[model samples]
Target: MSLVKKSLAKTASVVPSSTETHAPTAAIDVAQANAPVTENEQKEYPFFVAAIESDLAQLKTFTDIADKASYKSEALKRNDYLGYIKRYRLSGQNHHNTVLAWVFIWLVDLKRWDDVLELLPLMVEQKQPLPTVFNTKHWPAFVIDQLYDDANYYLSQSEQAGLFTISFVLHRLITTVKNQDWTGLEVVGGKLYAMAAKVDASLHNYGFAAAFAEQALAINEGAGVKGLLKDLQKLLKQSEPEQAVDAD
Candidate 1:
């Protein structure tokens, strides 16, 4: 599908199903539909479409309508991309997670971290997971508390998938440390240990020269790192820690 079409597809998922099945009054260009998809297509689809094609303009309107509709979960299940579709549509009764996930992906992709904070409260109102950025110093304590409240809510739903990249988590960790959120050091300490254990042990050969290590420890007095080591020590055989003892 075209980038615009695909994004519209996701956006359509959120629009109320009862709305007119056509484009809103907005004029869209047919020629733009023929534009190359090389740029947005090369990567995995972003959570939001950047521009709407003329043909798909009506679809965007439908999505806005769907966002306001009240639909039964069963009705939503009939759609192909149920998660995406249910996000913007339905009355306050919907509990879909797609909207929050898409919003996070969208904001992160746009590098609009501040705006993300603004949208986060709405997500919380809907009982969704908060983005992990607040776990670090990039945002204020009030923001972190709000984000953590949401994280705990989602964490109760399932053990975090543990699928986030160590680098992504570490980058945010530094932000938390920069903001003097000492508590973040402990929270991220476990994630670092988990990442180190899963990553190639060759990382130890580089010792602390690893980019993530430098970024995380730049502000920390190695205490956070030492805690990380202690966690890794529990997971590894004694000999591995012995070999790396000099590295510290």
Candidate 2:
């Protein structure tokens, strides 16, 4: 067997299946029965948590993006544990899974946009919490903040291609989080809308740009979109066909 299969087999022997249940013969047993995490999860959670902590500590040592990317590449090679955890969660089991959370964050950091999008809906459905290091209460807000920061970074570098790439993911994220309220939604969400507007404006898609800018302004007056909106409106007006004057 491969190393991953071997580790999984060993762990499986110790971890109880989700369907396994014990008759509560005492008060302690009753309390155990009511515990949120299954025996399987309790057994498996720590291994993944320890792995995530080690990865985070190692990641802190790298300053350059290339170094961090290389570290992530190496770390992802040992991520077979995630498959087991994902299966557990997808089987209607709900508990804090730091492994899944970190994987999502790392995927975002790596700019694996499609993978991130694929995982986002499941995370939202499971109501996954961000890791404590992020100090964010909700995952949706954290995602928007990350994407907004990415947009600004690309804009600062005058890298339109980067912005264009990020815009697609940003739009999908916005759609996913639409009507979802979280802490700092007005600020971060508004900024995201503003970023989308700016991107569309850069591409001369003035109509969509105006709409996004309006949404940003509506969400947060300080979203810094009023100037952009005015410019977009003027351009839209200039694009309108002038009236043909009849013979006087």
Candidate 3:
């Protein structure tokens, strides 16, 4: 027992009492670790908002359709439109600048069809929904909230969107025709011609329908489509002047 006690005391003495000791490992600072990289007050449009706004101000002065078209032409020649979209990140619909972006889409579809086409593939690549440049579900509803209380603004937008819609569809018709898509051409051509007969036997813009029919006939000159041509001609020969329909 004495020997065991001596051994224990020696062991205890051998453990240096003055050895340096370390504090326990500190716990991670969870709040600091999970903090956002960007501060809340930092500007979202820091890079090119000023430049974009300046360009947009110029567009705002282009209330005239012809003048606005000229601006679009000039911008496309210099590739200013594409740079604007990339710089402002205008491809998205959820940004703070959605209103501005959509307005840009409106003008582009009217006067910048090729640029609008240029954007379609990019939207597909980025997995973003196609912007309103191609498909607008309802024209007036689109502008009603934005152009509210100004009846003339609403009417002008509706009428202009209508004109643009027909022209845009015609553009598509020409594309499908060139691609030898008879079913597509037929489908598109049928809709326009049928729409002509809808309003009290009035051919609402059958001239474009006739244009599509002409293209379709040139592609497939079978007697099957001859009847359709005859029907369109009979309607065309009627005494009623063509009336334009607001693009729905």
lDDT of 3 by residue, 185-206 (tens): 4443333333322211222555
RMSD of 1: 15.0
lDDT of 1 by residue, 88-174 (tens): 332223344543444444444333445454454455455555345444332233343433343444334543432233323333533
TM-score of candidate 3 to 2 decimals: 0.31
C-alpha TM-score for every candidate: 0.24, 0.75, 0.31
Model 1, global lDDT: 0.38
lDDT of 2 at 181: 62
Model 1 poorest 10 in a row by lDDT: 68-77
Clashing pairs in 3: none
Q: Write the per-residue lDDT of candidate 2 for residues 1-248, one digit (tens) a residue.
A: 32333444676734223243553366755555455655665565566676677788989998999999888866766645445554554345676677788888888887777777778877888888887777776666667777878888887887888877877887787787776663456887688789899887877778988999998888899999999999999988876654223222
Residue 112 in candidate 1, Cα distance off native in Å: 23
Q: Give candidate 3 misplaced runs (Cα > 4 Å).
A: 1-46, 75-79, 84-110, 120-248
Model 2 — which ten-residue stretch has the worst lDDT? 15-24
For all candidates in order, the CA lDDT equals: 0.38, 0.73, 0.40
Native-structure RMSD, model 2: 8.9
